[model samples]
Target chain A: MKLSDFFRKKSSGSVAKDRLKLVLVSDRTNCSPDIMEQIKNDIIAVISKYLEIDTDELDIKITQTEVDGTTEAVPALFANIPIKNLKVH
Target chain B: MGEVIVVTSGKGGVGKTTTTANVGTGLAKLNKKVVLIDTDIGLRNLDVVMGLENRIVYNLVDVVEGNCRIKQALIKDKRYPNLYLLPSAQTKDKSSVTPEQMKKLADDLRDEFDYILMDCPAGIEQGFRNAIAGADSALVVTTPEVSAVRDADRIIGLLEANEMRRTHLIVNRLRADMVKRGDMMSSDDVVEILAVDLIGVVPDDENVVISTNQGEPLVGNDTLAGQAYMNICRRILGESVPLLDLNGKKGLFERLAEIFRKN
Candidate 1:
C-alpha cells in the first residue's frame, strides 16, 4: 500500500466549504485578517494583565454559531485561551 | 399591486441576467403578467437575452428622462402574451439613472404587471442600489465556486442592510458528475456555507448556452436547466417545490457518448 493510502485526503468540496466558512465569517463581521490579528493581540494584552495565558496556543476567530434559543446562525467571536496561572495582586 | 424583485450577484458572469430572463419567462408561462427590467444600463443584454433587442425604440433612460412614456418603452415578448421587457439604455452610463428614478419607475410598473423582475448589474455600486431601490425582495444568483459564493455572501449582506429581507438563493451552473466524484461542492454544501434559503439549483447544461445563443429562454422545456427554472418560479409563487435531484441518471445521449469515449 502507498503511504498516501494510509491517510485519507479531504475532498475538494470539503476544502472549499472549510475555506468559505472562514472567509465568509470575516466578510460578514467586517473583520479583515489584520483586524483579526489586532483583536487577538489586544485580547492577549488585556488578559495578560490579571492572568498568564499561553499565547502560542491561544486561538481567536469569528465563526457562525447558533444562538441560545434559535436556529438562526449568527457570526460569533470564538476565542480559546489557555490560562497558565493567575497573577497575585 | 405587483411584487418587484431584483436579480443581483456581486460578481459578474454568474448568470444574473440569465436567471432574470428565465425566471421572468417561467412566471409568464404560468399565466402571470411579468415584466423584466434590464438595469445593467451601459451594458444592456436582457434585450438580447429575451430576443427583444431589435424591437427596442424607447429605452429605460427615455422613460425616466420623460423622453417617452413608460408604456412606450415597454417591449412585449412575442412568445408570452403578458410578458414584457424594459430594455436598458446602452448609450448612457449607470449614472444616468438614480435610485429615486428607478423607484418611481418600479412603482409605476407595479400597477400594470403581476411580477416585475429587475436584472441588476454586478458589483454593489450605484447601479446595484438603483436596481434594488423599489424591490420588495431579491433573488441572488451564484455559481458553485469559491469566488462566486463569496461574492454572493457579500451581496446578501448588502441586501439585508437595505432591509430587503425576503432574499432567495439560486445556485447555478452546478456540475453533478463533478460533485458526485467529490470534486465540486454540492448544493447542500453551498446552502450550508451561505446560510441562505435556496430557491433552486440549476445543473450545468449545454442547453442553456444553446437557448441563450438562440435568443430564447429555456422554460417549459424538457431540459434539466429548463425544469429547474420552472421549479424556481413555482417556489416564488409560494408553492413548496422540492429541490431538483442532481444525482439523477444522465440522458441517453450523454450515457452513449460516455460509453463511446470509454472504448
Candidate 2:
C-alpha cells in the first residue's frame, strides 16, 4: 500500500509466470534460445534485402496466443521488426 | 475391468509417491478394492510410506519373473481391509522389468481390484515407460515452482504421445499464503500454464511431512491436505467435488455470505 512501492520491481510470482511462459512455449515448439537467435538472424537477413531494418531493436520469440473463434490457446511466432527505410533497388 | 492409473512427475521430489499413497488410501477408505503398485524399481519408497516395508517379502520383480504368484507378493495394508500394495524391487534396476510384463500384470489385477494406481519414477526413462505402459490414465503431480511446472508440461506431452490421453494434473505442495502475498504461483496459474485439467490441489502443509515420516498416508487424518486427497478420490470416481478452499479466509467469507442469505 505504500506509494513508494508502486515504482518497485515486479513481484516474484509475476516474474516466474513470465519466465515459465517463455520457457514452456519454447519447449513446446522444440525451439531453444539458440534456435530463436538463428531465426532472428534469418529474418533479418531476408528482410534487409527490401528494407533497412533496425536489427538492434528487433524482437522475436515464440509465445502463446489465442486464435479467433476458439477459447484454447496455441503457440505462435511473434516478431517485432522495426524498419528504418526502404532500400531503393 | 478396473482402471489403471499412473502417478508421475518428470522431475524428482515433486510428491508423486505421496500423492499415489494418499489417493490409493482415500479410494480404499471409500470401500473400493484398490491396489497400489510401486514401479520405482531400485529406489522404492512407497512401501515405507505405507508402513509396509517389513511385509514386502516378494515384490513386482518376483511376480513378473515367475518366482511367485501375484497373490503372494501383494502385501495387505495395515489399516484398510481392501487396500494392498505391490512393492517394487529394491535390488533390481529398471531394465529388469519390461513394458510387456507390466501390461500383463495390470491386466491381471484389473479383474480383482476396482482401481490400480502405479507410482511412477521421476524422469522420462525406462522406468517411466514401464510404469505407464499398462496405465489407462495418468495423474501428473507437480508443485507451484517454475521447474516443477515446466517438467509437468513435458510429462503431459509424453503421456499424450503414448496414447494415454486421460491425464489430469495434481498441483501439490502449494503455499496458499505465499500465493496470497504474491510470492508463489496459485493452482489456477499452474493449470493455465500447463494446459491440463485440474483434478485437485493440495496445499503445502507440515502435516504431510509428519504423516510421511510416521509411515501413514494422511488420507485418514483430519487435515486440509487429507481432505483435498479425499476430494480427489471422489472426483476420480466421477463425482464433481469442488476444490478445497485451502485459503481458509476465503472460505470464511463464503460461509458468512451463506448465513446472511439464509436469514
Q: Is model 1 an incorrect, acceptable, medium or high docking prediction?
A: medium
Positional deviation of B115 in candidate 2, in angstroms? 0.8
Q: Write model 1 residue lDDT over B40-69, tens digit each, in one string.
A: 999999998888899999999999999989
Give me the candidate number with maximum DockQ: 2
- Top model by TM-score, which number? 2
Instruction: Name model 1 segments beyond 4 Å from true.
Output: A1-7, A44-60, A63-89, B251-263
Candidate 1, DockQ to 2 decimals?
0.71
Q: How does candidate 1 fare on TM-score?
A: 0.86
- Scored on chain A only, each candidate's TM-score is 0.75, 0.76
Residue pair clashes in candidate 1: none
Chain A TM-score, cand. 1: 0.75
